[model samples]
Target: MSDNASFPHGPRWFAQPGTARTWRCASAPRQVRDFHAALTGYSPTPLTELPSLATELRIGRVFVKDESCRLGLPAFKALGASWAVHRALAERAANGERRGRVTLVTATDGNHGRAVARMAHLLGQGAHVFVPRGVHRQAVAAIAAERAEVTEVPGNYDDAVRLAAEAAAGPDAVLVQDTAWPGYERIPGWIVEGYSTLCAEIDEQLAAAGVAEGPDLVSIPVGVGSLAQAVVTHYRSRPSGHAPALLSVEPDAAACVLRSLVLGRPVTVETGETTMAGLNCGTPSSIAWPYLRGGLDAAVAVRDADSARAAGDLAALGVASGPCGAASLAGLRAALSGPDAGERRTALGLGPSSVAVLLSTEGTAANPRTVTDE
Candidate 1:
């Protein structure tokens, strides 16, 4: 409420109470952390406190989980990519499939492709990455830098995902997609499980910082909702039965989750170009929808200009952030201000003493910049 007047057509807020049940993880939190630890250059990403920003926002504290560098990649996608690949490979081995070099296949707007390629390179396997036409060329090059074959498809990300699924049907190929359809859920589920490592780390970091249960609110950037599902599941399933008020942020042009939440079912939207390239997804993952639909406290769609400003704000605080990453801040500003903000805040149980965690999903300029009409 401090700087609401300066906000442009801001921070649309939509929220409903969560009604979903919890799930049991396939592997325990310690096991997932151990798996990540076994990887090269594995360590917990930084959870930075921004007291100045917290003061500006008039909150107890604002903590950011920096994922700029995860396992040599410049994004958190490596966690999901590596763990999914490992599980996929292990399943093949268990089924008595011949041991041979296998190619990893996936579609990405950017980061996920490079991550899968990195894992493939490490495993002495091949990688073929498919990208939508709107994806930045630098992103394609980064994926290619891992020696993965890069293919530019005809339409949006969903179209590229279709082609990737087809290519992965080859006997020597394994599809490691992050989003899910009907029969394509198992791999994506493992990806979500992999992302549990992030929330698990957040718990440890918050405990180390002396926040016993957790922050009152956690703002997460949503693409296809896998990571958001992971966050929702992690907090809701806590042994102490304490969960944070989960908020999801997305690009206005592709707010599938927000739209789906409003309609009480999954729905797809036509996506357009935006600077938040990593989150330019048109559809929500079907498997993730159930968890998200029942667990999210709020969902917000932000403009490119708003996200850019938030990124700059983070930069001034020495937190390098891209549009997708900084979107958490943009969404937070709207959720705590704008229309019905006071009522919404009360419903979410947020107050001056409430702490908030912003999940910064990427580093600065992870994708090429795009022009947008402010």
Candidate 2:
């Protein structure tokens, strides 16, 4: 694994005026939750409250939404991948299409491909997963375990995405990608919709814990910004006026969303290699850009070393997190300890009374290097 200490950790703060008052509720959350529950055997993941960590961070409370084992998978990708695949198959069946054996294709660094492959195998369909260079051997084996055809691209994740798009050009092949471009927005939108389930679960868990008003701050990891977009949409759509200060976290090596926010438009970055493999995205998803641009309160790009340290921190808290999963905690710690900590905290509304929620997106199963005490 590469040491990421030399990378940039400059945190950016953006406050969008009238954003909290402008958002309106859309009737999609209930439908999304119902769909997942009825078909996917969905159950809410644990929202664990860590008092010790909260005391250490000097916050009122800290909740970690453990998505490591979502739907029997070691990551949260199954929530989106299963829903997208089902939606695609349902659409095909609605059109009276009788393509013999449907095939699903997508590009992923690791987790999403395995989820897509699992969904395809469950639905009695074929799957083709394209992974970028430098992907871990365990991840490739996991995808192949689902009987999906795994293809390793020679270049980066963006190159794998392009190759997957080319491979899915056939009539019988459906591309269940989580990121969107020009003509491929619908499925990705559905993928975002699928992630609404996690936010809904969080809300219920918070209420059950006697905090009915919801969290004041939320830290989420961004790949193509799909999951962060989902978080924004869910919170903004609530009638309870629960607009948490959204914090978007990403690896410094591939901080496409951060770069896009800085440029004031969607732009691709170089996306160099990082230990946060699941977040090694070069570009932001077109479908997610608008929400992220308007709803994000702050964005931070953390080095791989920060994430490695964060994984160890989470492990000490009894939470098994990978580098990508622990990036939210890394960003939080960065915000609280960086040179501009005072200004950043004031700008983000972080204080003694603030309740924060961190999304631990995946478990430390594939990447054993992230489990060290270093």
Candidate 3:
């Protein structure tokens, strides 16, 4: 079967989704290479094929882009967020600014903050990460491990964003926020550019396995949609015949992408409850909207029950994923087995021979199984 046949909108659908013409990021190959070079000492994450899961699902093949093993940091967010901070420092240094005096600021529920903190420590800069009240203790611990000062504020993810923005409004503090509003574009784009590394590695791994055609679908989790945008952008830049159908997964409580897809425009929904803290972003980011609206093929919002269940499943399977980490697999598992599975698969032109990949972004955060019980 033709690769594009499974996807109703075809492989170039991302092009029409309104992303190609929007504020394009510096996502060129050279930038990707430079970003990779900046972290030359770090080890590359693995792309492990899950033959057992594929057999159970009755699919031809399935691969998990495992980012849990990245530098002991659990998530792929570190790749992008850290790269953005480093690049921002590079930008400052290029302009003759004192790099050591620069401080990076960002709002996070967890992973991104740790990434920023990690970068700050490596580059001789300071970082301050803001998190919503009731943020996960383990997440805060992770960021603190990188020597960053962490602050918690009242409200949800949105409130933390506002607090961070206020702090970043000063001189010598660069806002490295993942969610972009107006007049602040570079960091978010750089985050996406950092994400290109994941896709680029996937390309190499797939080729090594002798898989010539692209996956039938690529499923990813969305918070502010930075990683999703990056994946879609990277895939779109490739030859049309090689790109896969892109699907985004989110916590049901924070179904911003579903709302956006349904409304045909961006909309923020109140995320009242979810165990998938990392995926609990209530609103779509302004910078992420263009790419999301243009490149995303479908979205599935999984409930907290499924997220926790997927987390447990990964643990049983010895994969070690957190609630937020296993969210994409939860959504994909539902999409492949629930009421919409068959139709969705057919509509997207997937079949038994089609290969699909899902990214497991982080390991169990604070889960006793993930860390040796102290």
Candidate 4:
């Protein structure tokens, strides 16, 4: 196989006749409203300006979308996966699937698994989550607290995903997977829609603050590209006359999205070599591919060192972040340093007048063993 080969793995085994149809799904305004309502108990995560970091980089402005407080989940995955599973359960109930007990299943490196477990527990259903072998102990414990059964697969994230899909297909289980391929499209799309709330809130907050246009650039991390797709979708659909350029970042070893976008298809790469464990994805989700292919403006792959440094920088600035969450800032930092980065900045008309946003997608507590490097 080529180093950049794209892998297609999913429920093609049991896919119905229409399973291979183009998987294009979007969040309805009403469903989005319902999702927001259900999640009201979650504190409105703060969007704070990183004045100190901005000054040091001489970037016009920088803002951090702090997701640490999301439903006490400490990760932004709570918004997407949990809300998606909730919506899925409601839909199943509408279809009479809830007359009997329904279970949701998925595989994760960590946070998405926890979100699925929490949603299952809250909705009176059971969940069986498959996790990668090297997943952190704390993350596993957190998922277990949601009362979900956790099984460790003997491979990487992609391997766990394969196993989950296999199990969910057997019998009456509902697989609320974040990555879509053949038969599964609706649930993953719902997950992406749930994440749209974050960007919508950012736009409203910035507008209310008297910033007419949106940020000059927005950076987000990629793990199967769901969150990145959500941000891109929201900006593309934003009513604002102007939208910021979207940049997606990933760890060097798991830059599958970058490779996929370049080749115009989903690709798989190596795993287990990056410290940004949350972004240690091998392939981009089929559900998220079209959004990244057309909606996002750029993609960057940064070294583990840069991501680690960003986590440290965030911690120093009173914003706690793990390596995966800090990958976006590392992309921003690289975009500021390279020669073409200057041109990209100029093309975006960014100067001291421009404002930028970086998404801190997880709390440092997710990886207690990962210390921020000085």
- Cα RMSD (angstroms) for every candidate in the order listed: 4.7, 4.2, 5.6, 7.3
lDDT tens digits, residue span 247-272, model 4: 78887777888777666678787765
Candidate 1: where are CA atoms >4 Å away?
Answer: 1-11, 18-30, 365-374
Which of 2 and 4 is the better model by TM-score?
Answer: 2
Against the reference, the lDDT scores of all candidates come to 0.83, 0.83, 0.74, 0.75
The digit string of per-residue lDDT tens for model 2 on 1-374 reads 01123444222433444354346546354677888788655678889998876887788999999887777787788888877887889899899998678889999999999889989999899999999987888888888888999999999999999999999998989998889999999999888888888988998999999889999889999999999989988877767665788889988888889778766799988878898999999999998998888778778888889999988988888888888889989988877775667766776777897899999998877434332211
TM-score of 3: 0.88
TM-score of each: 0.92, 0.92, 0.88, 0.87
Better of 3 and 4 by lDDT: 4
Error of 3 at 105 (Å): 1.0
Count of clashes, each model:
0, 0, 4, 1
**Worst 10 contiguous positions by lDDT, candidate 3:** 6-15
Winner by TM-score between candidate 4 and candidate 3:
3
Taking the tens digit of each residue's C-alpha lDDT, what string does model 1 give over 113-135?
98899899989999999999877
Model 1, residue 11: distance off in Å is 11
